[model samples]
Target: MPRSHPNSVTIPVGVVVRRTPGVTRWAKYAWTVTDILPGAAPADWKVLRSEGDVTEYHAATLPLTLYVPDAEAYAHELQARIPSIYTVLRPNAESGGVPWSVALVTASPYEAQDYCDSAEELVEKLPMPHGLHALIVEFVDKHYEEEAFVKRRRKNARVDQTDDGIGDARIRQTTDVYRAPRRREVAN
Candidate 1:
C-alpha cells in the first residue's frame, strides 16, 4: 500500500506568463509561464509588462503541495540541472485573453506525465527556486526511501504434442472453398 504524509506542506508560488503574438498560421497568440515567484500573494491575471502587443502578467499564485509519499519523486526532480515545477494550462472558453484556471503545480515526474498526456492542455516547466529546492531536499532526506525494483517471472505453460484437433478447424474446413482448382498439363 502507498503511504501519505500526514503533515504535508503547501508552498505558494507565483506564476508569470508571457503572452505574445503567435508566429504560426494556426494560432493567433502564444501563452507560456516559466518563472516562479515564491511567497507571492494570490492574484488573478494582472498585467506586469506591456510593450506594443506583447504582454507579460503575474498569472496566478498556485500552491505547490509536497507530500512525504512523493519525496523520492521530489528528490529526482531536484537532481536535474534545472529542477522545474510543471504547470498545466488550457485556453479559457469565455475570454479572448488567457485566464488562469486548472493550473497544476507539482514536483513529481509521475504527476507531470498525467498532464503531459492530456490533449486539451499545455504543460509548462518553470525553474524551481533555490530556497524551495533546499526545502524539498530537507523533506526528502527525512521521508524519501529508495524502493527496490523486483522483476517477476512468467509461469511456464505445458506443451501439448497430440496432432488431433491441433489446427484451426474453421480454416481447415474453408480451405477447399478458398482454393483454386488445379489445371491439368497437356503434352505437346
Candidate 2:
C-alpha cells in the first residue's frame, strides 16, 4: 500500500509554453516541459541553478504544492491558458501528449514573476501566436516523487547453533527483507 501523508496532496499539472525559432539550441530542446516528465524543469523543481554558459530560463515550469481550498479554481485558470491542442500533464500518464493544467499554485510568487518576465522577453523575440506573451503557470498536487521510499531487496545469511550440545546441531538460513534507514536533515 502507498503511504499517505497529512501534508501532501498528489495532482497533475500542465506546464505549457510556446516554442520559438532562432532561440538557443538548448532553449529549443527545453520547451518540452509541458509534454515530458520534468519536461523543461529541473529534477528538484527549484529554479535550476545556472551553470556558466548554460542557457537556463529564469521562468520555467515550476512544480507547485497546493493545500488551500481554492486550488481547483487555480487549476482551471491554468487550464484555460493552454491551447486546445495541448493537454494537461499527469504524472506518469500521457494525455495524448497534451499538457494538462495543474491545480497547484506557486510556492514562490517571486519565482513566478521572474518566469513571467523571461517568458515575455521570449514572446517578444519570437514570432509566436498573437498575444502569446506570458507562459502558463499551472499547479497540481497529484504528482508523486518518482523515487521510492525504500531500496531494493537483498539477501542475508545467518546460522544458529545449539549451546547445550556444543554446536552438535546447527541451522542456517537466508532471508532478504532489509530496509535502509531513512535519513533526515537536522534544521540548525
Candidate 3:
C-alpha cells in the first residue's frame, strides 16, 4: 500500500476559469475554458468581465495538499516553464451543469500516475505563485532526498552447447524459417 508523508500541509488556492467560444472543423460551436487562473479568490471569479461569448471567471478557492514524500517531485516540477499546481476536474454529479468538481493535486509523479489514466477527468496545470514555490522548496530541502539510481546487470546464462545443439541433427538442419537461401540458388 502507498503511504503519504506524515508532514503534509494543505494550502488554499484560487482557480481562474475562462469560457470561450471554439469552432471545430465540423463547424460545431463549443464553449471551453481556455485559460486557467491560479491563486484567485472566489470573489474574483464572481466579478469577471464578459464580452460577447468570451467570459472570465474566478472559479473557486480550494485547498491544495502537499505531502513531504513528494517534495523532490515538486522540486522537479518547479523547473518547468510554468511551475504549476495541477488540478483535476470532473463533471459535477449533482449539479447536472457545466461547472466541474475540482481537486488540487500535490502528489509526486509516482503517486499521481493513477489519476493520469482517467479519460473523463480533465487535468489542468496552473502556475504556482512565488510564495507557494518558496514554501514547497523549503519543504523539499528539509525532507527530500535524491534517490541514487543503480543499474542492475543481467545474469549471464549458462551455455551447455553439447547437450542442446551439438548432438542434434535437427539443430544443424537449414530450415527455410531459420536459414537464408543462397543468392545463386535463387537466381537458378
Candidate 4:
C-alpha cells in the first residue's frame, strides 16, 4: 500500500477466484471470486491451491484506492452485518484465457451496484480481512467527518398554483365527472 497523498491510500490487492465443476450441462465451470489479498505480490492466474477439481487462482492484482471523499461509503460498508469487499468480473474471455477477467475491485456498495445494474459483469462480495478492517477503521477515524444533519424546510409552494393541465392524462377508467379535477380560473 502506498500513500499517494494526504487524502488517499492505494493498496495493491490480489483477487483470488475459485473454479468448481459446474452442476449443469450447459455450464462447464462456476467461477467466483473467493478472497482478496492486500499488499499481495502481482500475480496473473497463479494457481494457489487445489482440492480435487476445485481450484483457486490468483487471477489479478488490482489497486484498491481509498479516498477521503469516499470515507462515508467505507463507513457504511463497515457498519453492515458482514463487512465486504466487492469484486467485479467480466465474462467472455479470449481463447486460452480464463473464463472470467477481473474488471474491478471496490469498497463502495454504490459503485458495486452500478456494475450490477449493467448486467454485463459478475459481482462478488468477499468477507473483509481482519487486517484490512483494522486499517480501514484507522483510515475512517482519521479522515471521516460526520456531516451535521440539516433538516430541509418545506417551502410553501403549491403544485396547483396555475393549474396548467396541458399534459394531464384525460383517459381514466372512472367515468365519474365530479371526481375529475377542474382548473380554477384565477381572478386577474
Residue 7, model 2: Cα distance from true site in angstroms: 5.2
Instruction: Give the candidate order by descending lDDT.
Output: 4, 1, 3, 2
Q: Which 10-residue window of candidate 3 scores lowest in summed lDDT?
A: 27-36
lDDT of 3 by residue, 1-188 (tens): 33455798776666666666666676323433344443555543353678987776666677666777667788788667777667666666876434566654453544455567988777765566778878787877887888899988658854544443334465555444435556665554
TM-scores for all candidates: the values are: 0.73, 0.22, 0.64, 0.77
Q: How far out, in Å, is residue 73 in model 4? A: 0.3
All candidates: CA RMSD (Å): 6.7, 19.6, 5.7, 8.3
Candidate 2 regions off by >4 Å? 1-8, 11-34, 38-64, 69-75, 78-114, 117-188
Give the 10-residue window scoring lowest on summed lDDT in candidate 2.
121-130
Let me know the TM-score candidate 4 reaches against the reference structure.
0.77
> Model 3 residue 137 lDDT?
78
Comparison by TM-score, 1 against 2, better one = 1
- Cα displacement (angstroms), candidate 2, residue 129, comes to 22
Worst 10 residues of 1 by lDDT: 157-166
Return the clash pairs for model 3, or none. Answer: 16-37, 45-58
Q: Candidate 2 lDDT, tens digit per residue, 37-59? A: 22243332333334543433223
Candidate 1 global lDDT: 0.79
Candidate 4: residue 38 Cα off by (Å) = 1.1
Local error of candidate 3 at residue 62 (angstroms) = 1.7
Extract clashing residue pairs from model 1: none
